[model samples]
Target chain A: MTINSVPSSKVRVRIGHLYGDLLNLYADRGNILVLTRRCEWRNIAVEVVSIGVGDRIGSGEFDILFMGGGQDGDQQFLEDDLFRVKADGLRGAVHDGVPVLAVCGSYQLLGHYYDPGTGPRLAGLGIFDMHTVHPGLSVRRCIGDVVVDWIGAPVGGPSSVVGFENHGGRTYIGSGARAFGRVVSGNGNNGEDGTEGVVQANAIGTYLHGSLLPKNPHLADHLIGMALARQTGSAKLEPLDDHLEWQAHQTILDRRASHVAPVGGRVKGSGGSAR
Target chain B: MRSRRLRTGFAVAMGQIAGWVSRAVGRGGGTALPGLVVDYLDPSALAHLARQLPGGVVMVTGTNGKTTTSHLIRAMLEAAGWAPIHNASGSNLSRGVLATLLRHASFTGALRVPENAIGVFETDEAAVPRVLRDTRARVLVVTNLFRDQLDRYGEVNAIAQQWRDAISALPGSHDLRLVLNADDPTVSALDGGSATTIRFGIGDPDVGRDAPDHASDANFCPVCGGRMRYIRVTYGHLGDFVCDNGHARPTPAIVATDIQADGWEGTAFTLKTPRGERRVSLPVPGLYNVYNALAGVASSEALGCDLEPIASAIGTFRGAFGRFERFTIDGRRLVMVLAKNPVGMNEALRTVVGRGGSGHHVLVALNDFDADGRDVSWIWDADFEILVGQVSCLTISGHRADDLAVRLKYAGVIGSIPSSGTVTVLGGLADALDGAVSGAPVGGTVVAMVTYTAMLELRSLLVRRGHARAYWDDAGVNSPEVTAR
Candidate 1:
């Protein structure tokens, strides 16, 4: 669909990709690209503003805020900027119910604190009532194909979401926050509880960083709907053809199933091995 | 010593038998079986066999271009009257290297082909330390390091630390000559002070990118916490850079000046060495390959090879298999480029689009198999968005075809063209190859950009279809059939 086809009266979804360049370690830019393209395919205008380190982001300037994972060094470079420069703006946006999706490193930073096991614990923005700990160097990272049964999903959203997750931190969801989903396969959160990700109001914090959206079109559309609803006061998203997307989603599920041996109840490829 | 030599002979004989058995079973080339047998029989088999070479061994290791650079060095060594034993099958692991050495050595652990033959083996970055600990290589060439296979190798810094440790531990009397990439900050900083280090880099300012790429790593000065200022960034973080703390790019002993890179026809550069300057033409394209050629040239120069013959050999050198290797299938030209990580994939995409222009048929096969690095997340780091609206027909194939198709669609590549191009996703490599070949216009080029294992699968399919020769049988990219295409 052409950009001009959308009526001027229709509200456009504005996305502020926080630390788009630096914190984009898992190809997390694909999330933003998918969100924009899905919106555009539905004849909805989408504007993406990259909010980098030391860049000032205005309150309520965007309908949605996206932050992806980053390397340890890169996260260290942005820790001060997150707390000093963009904390207030981000807090205000979240207070205004602007949908926020933070994955892995950004998810850890959205919590109360993140202990990287080497340096002093990094203070997070405290947007979510959760904290993450990197359980020493001896501990292996939680990585592989992750399938989660999404709880409290938006209307018309899928019951499950599939994505690849690679993270070392073990997040513990505390009071004032709810689990976003239940782990169907693979490690979620601390690998102890079945919980995966944090859900507090409209903000999402998860370690699922296969960009976490391209394979899960339903989730992408739901986030877009939430952001558009916050701005336009009503969410009426027209359904676009998602054949290829569902095909991708199912392929991951099939891959996960094939990796699990039914008889012994043992996980073959579910662990954090690189295959 | 006699007993140990007898044990080595037994190990070598077992390895040869195992290699023969594997090949007889039609399991393709016995690249690693023999090495496994030898390692099992005697852990020190490789080191023992390597000591038999009078000319010693040369090790090439880096994140990229290791295979091509090692092949180029082998070509130059052959031209200079040295029959070099090399692992030319794109196998850089320890097992592969051992197998290559065992293939050329007799049961007595002596050079079978030529008494004066040397060894040139491309080693994996993680395998470098183990290889170094086992053998005293005469020359070590490090192409460059980038963020690659995070799941397999933790990070670039970790690998760099490993290299530093390995380099420092080498015996001083061994006189290991290090050929380093002067442009790569991580590589250039690896002057361990114990070895004679020679640096090679691109000196042409015109070849630099307008700015550093979005995914550029190593931008921060390793010496200081301050940021690095780049005068020019050729691709990613490789270029001239200096830090506020007085840390700067090293002056390369071997440099390429006035580089003229034609994506298809190949790259031509004025090679400036410590001996003299000469014009060198590389059959393979990309600035990365230019760096590879410089690494080869510097390593050859350190070996006391005549610069004239080395330059002449490089001028006629084609690339390794699946490294921009071309073939004609069903009257359709197909150039296969192997891209396993972001930087390599970006370069391959640039080479394809730059040469083929708009409306080109492009096949991208992404596999997450073991050899290809199961983490497909790096594909997102590559700038595939550049192909949006550029190609007429794009086919995504492999075990992870759906993932790549989703990525391409999100990049707006599927529907970006005015007359929206066809974007097909096939599950099988053979099917994808057939689709791309049949759909491509006659006489037009179809660039197949594949991952490590995907390239093998595609090449095997082509061989079965009588389009391309088996990788082992094919001489090199400069083979008569390949060059004629």
Candidate 2:
């Protein structure tokens, strides 16, 4: 089948990194870097504008909106900014079918609310139909290397994406939302559900942040292609050699598999357990 | 007390046997294993062993520089004619301290050293409370606190709370002296109500940066919720900072002034303490080491050591192993630097790129083991972008080579490499080391920036290759052939 193509016209893909400085707890800026480099490699023009607290973005300013995780203290400070300054702009961007990737803390903030178990419930942007809550007093954070089978992409995405997830909030997808993937290993969203992340409209929210992109080139390319398609009406991105990227992704998968306990075997205890 | 001493003696004997058996079986140093066995046999082994030191115990705990600072203090004390026992194996855990103490103890559970022999220990940040609960420490030297190992220790504030609780619970008669980093707001705020606190910092404004880096932590004032305005940010959130509410960095009792950081050659500075001013030419690179040296000076002075010998000892002190140790192999130079966090990694990268010569090679090894903090995402926070167009070649290695390779690629380092082969990713450390060494031009240096466990692994590989001595076998600071540059 001949793939539909459009003439390359130096398409400018703008990305607005919300809370680029404050909410970068897990190197989430790497995701923005990955997006920018992947586009530059294809001769596509890319621009990234950092939108921190009190910073505003125009409705049509960016093709992709990226948000990363931050410390609990930072999240508490950013909650007011997200609602006051960025909620409308980001909501319009998502409504325009612009691709959004929010990880960890920002992922929780994209939902309706985030209840951190002890403090006042934080208001979210209500972009994705979901809510996150702390796993209560007795439960620890759901953290480790995670592997998931991709389920939200239309076509040509990878069968699986591997990354690391470290978060205390367990998100539950609401009735209007859909899960981005099926959890293959490690806790996702919550340990109870075999689901990881939320996919609503063109926005995706996840806890996976081994930077979330460099290892999963397909997902990175998918978001890039979606951004380009939105810009140029229709486009097919030329693929770069991802041999090393696949190697890295497969390595994480293998590591996760090895770390997972065998069926009915002894559970691996948390770190700091004396031998 | 007699029965308890007898039990401790029996435990020490068993621990020694265990250490011998483990070493004979080629299972590495087995330092912590002996302590574990001892603790299992006698729960009071650490307390009993710690009580034998006539000079009392000194505890050093912080997020970074704990090992190096404790080592420097130990060296200063030794130079002053005091035999100091320390956990020199880079093992700062409770069991590691117990094992070191047991090694110095006689078979009768009595310290075998001289009467004035002291005990200096580097305790893990999270393990400080537990260590203080057992031993009667006379001095507690907290270097600084940053957000590290979030998966292991919840958050910076949580760890600070733990430390506060630990300090509050100290006995009324303990008379503890606290040596803290005045620049680090989180660490400086950890002053216990009754303890005598001595603050140390860098007073040289010339060495400070114009602004804080992206990964700088504790940017807000601890006293007020106002944003902190830094007058001079040496590195990260360290240096002189003030808040709108009039809260400012504490006046450090011991400060390094007139700083001259000569890159890899060494840093020469004049230390101004309450006692007097002494010029200290520390044979180490990076401002972090300067801070570590200042911490050592303040800590030693707090313990009543003379200023001249302490400054002289710090001047000659080479850094702790893997902190930044230089070695020459096959006409190529290897500088091993430990980069466990973003702040540390950025400093290492700055030191490397600041070398200013071409044909420089960097091999970054990352591991997600418990020791190295299972989350490897902090690599993104490190400013590897500085090396994008700078280095001639780059190699990514270790268990998480791909993750690092991806980070480097996104940082624009890989794309800037003139050739594809220059940005190679080798999974095995042995192969990566061999490739990096051979790949380097003759006389060119290969900076091996590695994490904690990876540093250990790389050092072992070097030891096997006859490149360096085993850390356990190396003598103290005055060991011959151990030079500054």
Candidate 3:
């Protein structure tokens, strides 16, 4: 990969951060930082517009969409606004091939519904053919460093991505759906299957939330290229040195390979059982 | 009662034996082992031991500044001529409390202490309810609550609810006195019942930041789930706030005004209470320490101490171990500051950057050990960008040194290009310390910001090098020579 100093034309990219204030858990803003800085380094202008409750998403308003996880009750607080107000806009955007990246809780909300194994089932946007089920309060959360091989990627793109995962909902994709990757280590989506995330059109849904982008620059650029291809006329992106990023990514992979699972593993108990 | 005393005596003996064996084998400080053994032999050992104190227990709990605030309160109590038993080593679990009590107890399960002996303990956020149930502490001082160790303690709101339930469930005759931070909305609302609440806040508007911090864990109102409006924000969500649902900040009874924070020298502020006003000069840096000082004054006053001596004690207090400690190795000054979570790390960076001169040498060590939360994602949430133009040398260490280096790169402190000798990543703590200290001039200072376990390891390394004494052996603030920087 060569770093191009000059491009044929000036390109400006717009990003829509859904519920940026409410749904940002585990320092999810690092994804935004990675995307903006990578583009800036390539001399591409980027604008991030945070879309909160009762906010409207116009057509072609964004080239890429991102949503992150939140606290357990925070999802409940924003559920009505997400489903009633922004579901159709999100569905329309995904249909238009706008590259979307949704993390843990937001990924669960993008599915058909999330049954928390309690009183009510939270309705999702139905963007993907999947649904999540929390086994019960007795089951331990899938919290640990996760490594996944990027199975469905463009040729010569990122081979694998590494991040940290902390989620309780076990998401199962439908038979017709395709997976984003295969989990090489750590529990992903569920502990039973080797599947990690789901892929729908140009959208990606995963539970990896070490912000999921600073360490995996290749995956970030892959999303940027897709968004550029759909929104702009050209998809050409200049590559920069990712030495530190790759080192951070390989550090987790090396640690995972060298020892037993870092911290989180499958066990029984409630949320406060760590005490 | 006779049988119960005999059972307690047996548990105490067994716990002491275990602790002795643990120390003989060079395991740990044997902080939590004795408590675990006692809990197994006699489940109610904590309550039985805690009840023996003539002057009851005083607890300090919050997400941040628990250790420092408890240390300040203990100093204030000692200044008023009372010997207080404290968990000074910073082992703050329920078991750690039991261990402290066991260390103060006789082999026959009897507490041996001075006639004016009291108890002061800093407890973990999740273990508050358990500690309360055991000690029945008469005075509880809450500094502030921030989102910390989500992997271990779950969520901030869940912990708040647990604290409220615990407070409300106390016996009617317990007469609990609640000392809270009025600037923190979540902590201010913890006093819902009939307990006498002494609220403390920063009244100086000059210290407020122009823009809110990145970590706003308490932006939502604690009373109702509505978005809160901050009239003034001191730091990270600590400010005067109001919700549209009629919930507003209470008028703090104890307030700090006319603040002046000198980077490492210390922070001075006017401590105002109903009794009178006194100017307190704290030997600690940052606005968060101002809050810690006010909490110490409010808590000790609740324990029947005069405001004059309390202010003097806070004025001369050095600091808790690893919160901010100084050492001299070959004439190079090493300042160790503990940065556990995002908010704390932000304040630590702000203090370092606010120091007078440029070319600041900083060694940041981040670990993912059990003590330091396994998920190191919170580093991204901290504002290391403040070091962009200030840091002349940056060294990253600990188990997650690569992650910290990457974070500093994205924060613009480290360039995107290859190594330029400005940023170095060394995984070994001792090597990183040596590199950072030697990279600076002999007369210059090197600031070391580290996580919980990393600070412990670094302090141990310093002790081994004969730079400082062991933390558990540290005498109180009465001896000015020990803490003289």
Against the native chain B, each candidate's TM-score is: 0.95, 0.95, 0.95
Q: Judge the docking of candidate 1 as incorrect, acceptable, medium or high.
A: acceptable
Q: Residue B341, candidate 3: how far off, in angstroms?
A: 0.6
| Tens digits of per-residue lDDT for model 2, A1-275 | 01122324567888888877666677776788788778777877777878866878787788888988776665666777788888888888888889999988788888998787777887778889999888564566676778899896557556798777767678999999999899988888887889999998888999898778878888998888889888787758897988878988988777765765411111122221110
- C-alpha TM-scores of all predictions: 0.91, 0.92, 0.95
Model 3 per-residue lDDT tens digits across residues B1-485: 98989999999999988877765665566677888999899988899999898789999999889999999988898888777888877778888888878877788899887778888989988788888988999999999999787777777877888898898898988888999999999999998834478889999988887455776787577888887888899988898889878799999888999999877889988889998998878998988999998898889878878877788898789898898798898888989999999999999998997776667888999998878888889998899988876877889999999999889888988862234346789999999998998888888899999999999999999988899877766733112111111
Identify the superior model by lDDT, candidate 2 or candidate 3: 3
Candidate 2 on B243-331: residue-level lDDT in tens?
Answer: 87988888898999898878677789999988899888888888898899989988888898888889889878978899889989899
| Model 1 segments more than 4 A misplaced | A1-12, A115-123, A261-275, B1-3, B108-115, B171-174, B192-195, B244-246, B417-421, B475-485
Candidate 1 lDDT over residue span A37-103, tens digit each: 8887777877888887688779768888999866556567678889899999988878888889998
Residue B83 lDDT, candidate 3, scale 0-100 = 78
At residue A27, what lDDT does model 3 achieve? Answer: 91
DockQ for candidate 2: 0.36
Interface RMSD of 3: 3.0
Ranking by TM-score: 3, 2, 1
